[model samples]
Each structure stands twice: as structure tokens, then as C-alpha cells.
Target: MTPANSDGCSPDFPDEALAAELDELRQLLDGTDKPACAEEGEGLVIMRLCSGLTLQEWEGLGARRDLRDWMALPITANPFPYLTRIQQTLKELVFLSEHDPLTKLHNRGAFERILSAELIRSSRSGQPLALVLLDLDNFKTVNDTYGHPCGDRVLETMGALLAAEKRTYDYAARVGGEEFALILPGVGMVRAEGIVERLIESARTLRVVCDGVDTPLCVTLSAGIACTKGKVAIGWEKLYAMADEALYAAKAAGKDRVRCAPIADLTGTPEKTLVRADEKRFLFTGTTKG
Candidate 1:
């Protein structure tokens, strides 16, 4: 007594019901009747009906994306197609707003937003946050001698290196031309020192060569770090100012070196390690291992 078709897998409607459906379909195709517009999920069903006269044909291409892609084309006029594309475009726009187009890293605004959030989280949890600012040493000379194109390659290499090497929770951003920032949440001074040292060492060896050039170009980094001392503290502005001060200190000492914001002002009393491309320097505790 259950409704079933000859296939026995689908409910079979009475002849009258089938005839009524066929009449409605015929009227729709003839443009004598029009169905109300609907959303994408339902729109897919309607599209299948429009594309195929037979159930077998609809089943073949029903789930494929060619239909949606075809619908978004310039020649298509239906409004339903715009629904899917609108969603996709909005996501792309959000990403572009936060990311730098050249290096494909988070831009300065995005970095500040992330840093502000992390400071709140660090203050609440009493975990340390390390902020590092790195500037390319002798960057003007590199650009003047090698040209801007080669300089661009150097920045790209640094961005890519930071993206690949930083911890998963850390955030990397291209804050300015030849300038980059790293935000490490839940990381303290000593650990921050090791992390920054490793990053600079890795960057030191990257070979950026211009076309028709045999020698690899040298573009080194001078870094400064400021950390919240395993305590509840730091407004975003204060944190950035401290890091900037540390960065300039590194520049004044010599190029291609790492410097930390004075611990007396911040937090933690651990021996600080400084990484210089040439000597492998350390401060406070003073040990030269390299």
C-alpha cells in the first residue's frame, strides 16, 4: 500500500499527480507561468529543471559547480547567481583589508588590532607577550646600488621567512617598507631572545640575487624586543613605544644586531641574549658562544 515507483526506491505518485506536475513544468518552459525566486539551495533544484528535461540528465550535472560558475557569467541575468558570488567576494574583501598586497602579510592596522587583543589576553592571564620590531640595516644602500626591484625581493624573502618560522600563535606583519613586526603571545623575555636570535640568524643566510647577478645580495636586520614581565600590564601604545625605543638602540649599537628594552622598566630579571650576524653577542650575563 506504500507509494512507490517501478524502481522501488522512490515514492510513486498517482497518474493524476504526475500529469499535473508535467502540465506545470510545460507551462513554466513555455513562459506562460513563472516560479517564485528562491535561495541558492533551492535555486540549484530550479536550475536543474531549467537545464535538463529528463531526470537522468539533471542527476549527471546537478552537484557540479559548472552550473554556478556558468550562472555568474556576464551573459547570465538571473539574480540567484549573485548570492554565491556575493558571499565569496565579501570574504576576499575582508582579507585584502587586513593584508599587505606586496608581501602577503598582515598590514600595520591588522598588527595593531592583534597586538591590542593579545595585550588584553596577557593582562588577564598574567602570561608574557613579546613584541619585536625589525628594520632592514643599510636598506637605502641596497635599494640605491641594486635597484628597487631587488630591494623588493629582499623584503619578500624576509616576509616569507617570518611566516614560515614563527610559532603558530605568533602574528607577523609588514608594518612599513623594510620594516616588520612579530607578536608572540604567552612568550617571555629569554624565550623571546632565543626566538629573535634564531630568526635573525636564519635571515642572515637567505640569498636574494637579482637577475643577471652572480653574487647574492646582503640585506641584514636590526631587531628590538619589548616584553610584558609575566605580569598584568601594558597598553598597546606603551608596548609599541617601548619596542620602538629598543629598535633604535639596536641601530645605534651597530647594524645587524638584536637589543632588548631594559628589563628594569618592563619585567623579568633573566640574562639577555643578543644575536649579531657577525659575533653572536649576549648582554647582562655576557657570554660569547659563537
Candidate 2:
């Protein structure tokens, strides 16, 4: 399947590449090799040939032969060039539908879908799932001061950082301008906080070399974390809202820090706790450069 670019579209296929694939398929189908017994969808039709076979012999065995018998034939070959290409094209389309072209991460729509599906699985398995929302600190200042191109460079750097940090099962996505989301299945609050701490350190160390700049540009990230264990009967929407609240708290306290939403706020209880956690709970690891 062709992977989608940031714009959410499959890359244009080159004429030369298509032609080369066609040529290779033609070579495989050339009459030198015996064609394997071919069956179309649902066994509704089959294609096979046995040279000089009597009508009676053909009728007795029917038109189809076992795959083992076809494999035993010295001249037998697989012939389905069109089918192979179609399958590949379909796969490419699926990839384009789900992936973001720019950062090569799952797009928002795909992320939401996966979040719902994962929540269902978590509910069934009684496993914890956590979500982290990240926003770049001073992103607008970078854009206004250095220009949008430089800002884009910083965002691209962030995308790479998030991609590298993602585990095999994690779902990471670019959900908005200068904002990213990470879905951590089978992970609880403490481990998720540790992950965010490492990310904060990485953000502090990240540098982008903008055009015509003697010094590299550095930016920090502010994030909020929310987990399934936060509240009973909470779904993705509540979790996300709680994460967003925590994110605002991070921004209010200071940029370049991580905050986690507690159960009271997530559940929308009358006694919602607005008190921010201590600095240690902010999950800051290194000095954040303004």
C-alpha cells in the first residue's frame, strides 16, 4: 500500500515504477512455465489446462486440481499479476486513509477510532489506558519571531521525537497545530508519567537549525495526562477533556511541564479539585529554555 503523506493522500505513483512492475509480471507469465490451477473468488470459477486431456478425463476430475498437485508440477508457476497489483493498491489506500503525511503519524480521525477501539479492549480486559496531550510552548513566538518555516522545522523535529519515543503498541498522533497526542494502552499513571518525563527531557534538548541562523532554535513542550483509572464509566471524551484541563494547568503553572488529571476533575464531581500538584508532580526533568 502507498503510505499517505502529511496531506492525507497517497503519493503519486511514478510511470517508470508502474511500467517496471508490469514488465516483471509479464516475464513471470510467459508461456515457458506451466500455469498453476487458478481459482477465482468463492470457487465460482476455475482456470486450468492439461494438454491432450480427453473430455471424459476432464469431466471425471472436474476442472480444479489440488494446490499440492499444482505444486508438484515441474513447470507450474503462480500467475496473478493483476490481482497482486490490486491488493497492493488497496493496501496503499488504507494507509493513506489512516496516516498523516507530514509527521507520518496516525491522523486525528485514525487516532480517535483507535482510541475508541482500544477503550473497548481495555474495558473488556480490565487493563489501564492512558492518554497524553502535548502542546509546544512558545510555538507562536517562534513562528512570529523566526518565521513559519522555522516554526515548521521545530514541529517536524517534535514529530520525529514523538515517533521515536512511541512503543510498538502505542498510538501517537498529531491532533492539532503544535499539538500531539499519545495513547498508551496497558499503561498506568506512574509509568505514563515516567514516559512524559523522558519526553520533557528530550524536548529540552531538541534543537532546530533554521535558515540564516547562527544559533539553533530550541522549544519546550507542555503536556497533560489522563488515564482510564481516573474515573468510573469514563470514555475517551471525558479522558480527553480532563487531559485538556490538566494541559491548561500546565500552561498556567509554567510552560514546559507535565500535569496529570485526577479522578475528581475527570468525573465532573461537585468537589472538583482545582489545586495544582507540587513542582515534583509537574514531571520536569531539565532546564526549559524560554
Candidate 3:
């Protein structure tokens, strides 16, 4: 005889067939213990078993309970207890990939990405952009004299100062052991030079305290500032090379000073006054802007 369906025990089935089906179901349940029913919130259900199978497999084993009807149960209240930890781990990984571990600033890769985006924006808007390259003068001497610990302290201190001194829209990245690069958007060569001068002054006055004594360690920085205006094929490489040349000039002249190449050198010079408005007042011999 055909076996009777066990679904809700239909009344159409004969008594003998129903008894045989019931016996088969009992044997199946005995071999594989029935899973415990648990409610997983307002509109969900979870089946828990004392076996090796997972929740999905156990739920597929013939559970037909409406999840919304079991909302009052608390057995499956929290499904993912480690969600916060997982999120934190992901955030840490992202930060480690994009930021420098020692200075907590943008790494060289991150800096390049930002610079590229800014370059596109500046090129489209016709706004000028400035690139400044700075290197610590005689930093190795400091390391040899005061020790590596002190050198680390100096680098950290300088990095913090540079970060704090930058404008909100500016980007500064530590590119090497004693080198840094700053990208200034919407700034021209003249303004960039002024900024570099201020940076040099600030570095000169920065004091590093070591060994519980007020050790007045004076560190000098040489910087080259280059500004670009029109559409240029060379792009960042052009600016970088110009700044590198200017930096070489600064080092050759004397360390601890700011050097800037005229925009005319990078792009064709405009017929405007080279001197600033304020500078014109103090100058004894120079053409003034009309």
C-alpha cells in the first residue's frame, strides 16, 4: 500500500496506512533527534540542534513555523554578537593600509591619490596649485648625537607641527625618513613662497626637550616651492622636478632657507609685476603693478 502523507495527518488516509507512516516518522526522529524550536525575533525563526549541522541545514529539515508568530521568544535574541568587533577590525585594516604607523599621517600612496584628485580639480577650474618639497638639514647628525630615540621624537614632533600648521584643504605627507611634501590647491607661486618662508621660521624656533633638560636642539629645513597654472603635459613630474631643482639651489646657497622657482620658468611668464603689492612699497627700485 502507498504510504500516507504525514503533513497535518490528512483525514483521507486509512487507519493502517496512517499507523505505518507514524511508525516511519518515529524511526526517522529517533535516528536524527528533533531540533529545538527557537524564535529569532519579530519576524524570524531559528532551529537549534545538538548535532554538527548548521542553522540553515536544520531549518530546511521540515520547519514550517511562521517567524512573526514566535516574536515573544528570547532564545535567538542576538544572532551576531561579534558584529562590532568585526567592524572595528575592518576599520583598523583600512587605516593601516592608508596611513603611516609612525606619524599617523597619510602615507605616500594615499598622498599621491589625493594629489591626483586635486590636480584634476585644479586643472578644470583653472586654479593654481603649489607643490613644496622639504628635507630636514643634518637630521642624521641629530640621530648620531642624541640617539635614535631622540631622532624619533624629533620626527614625531615635526610631523605633528606640520599637520597642525596646514590649512584644512592642504595635504601634507611624510614621504621619507627626513622628507615631506605639501600640496597647496588654489595657491600661486608667490603665496606658496610666503608659506615656505613661514615654515622655515617655525622649524627654526621648534625646540626639542630631552633627558628632563631643556635641550635647545635647533633643526633647519630646506624647502622648494613650485606653482603651476595652465594645462601642462608633464603634470606632477614637472612640478616635482622644478621643486627639486629649487631645493638644490637652496642647499647650494645655504641650508635652512626657502627657495621658489618663478612661475615663468614652469609656464610662460605673464606680463604682471613679479613683486608683491606690499613688497613694492618697501622696494627702492622695482616696477609697480598698474
Instruction: Assess each prediction's global lDDT (C-alpha) against the native.
Output: 0.72, 0.71, 0.68
Screening candidate 1 with a backbone cut-off below 3 angstroms (N, C-alpha, C), the clashing residue pairs are none
> Which residue segments of model 2 deviate by more than 4 Å?
1-83, 264-290
lDDT of 1: 0.72
True lDDT of residue 113, candidate 3:
84
For model 3 the TM-score comes to: 0.62
Q: After superposing candidate 1, which stretches have Cα over 4 Å from the reference?
A: 1-82, 264-290
TM-score of each: 0.64, 0.63, 0.62
Record all residue pairs in model 2 with backbone atoms less than 3 Å apart, i.e. clashing.
1-92, 2-92, 5-101, 6-101, 6-102
Runs with alpha carbons beyond 4 Å of true place in candidate 3: 1-81, 212-214, 264-290
Task: Summarize candidate 3's per-residue lDDT along 188-262 as a digit string, tens digits.
Answer: 888888898999899999988766436668778999888777444235666777887888888888889988876
For candidate 3, what is the lDDT? 0.68
How do all the candidates rank in terms of lDDT, highest first? 1, 2, 3
Reference-based lDDT, residue 129, model 3: 87
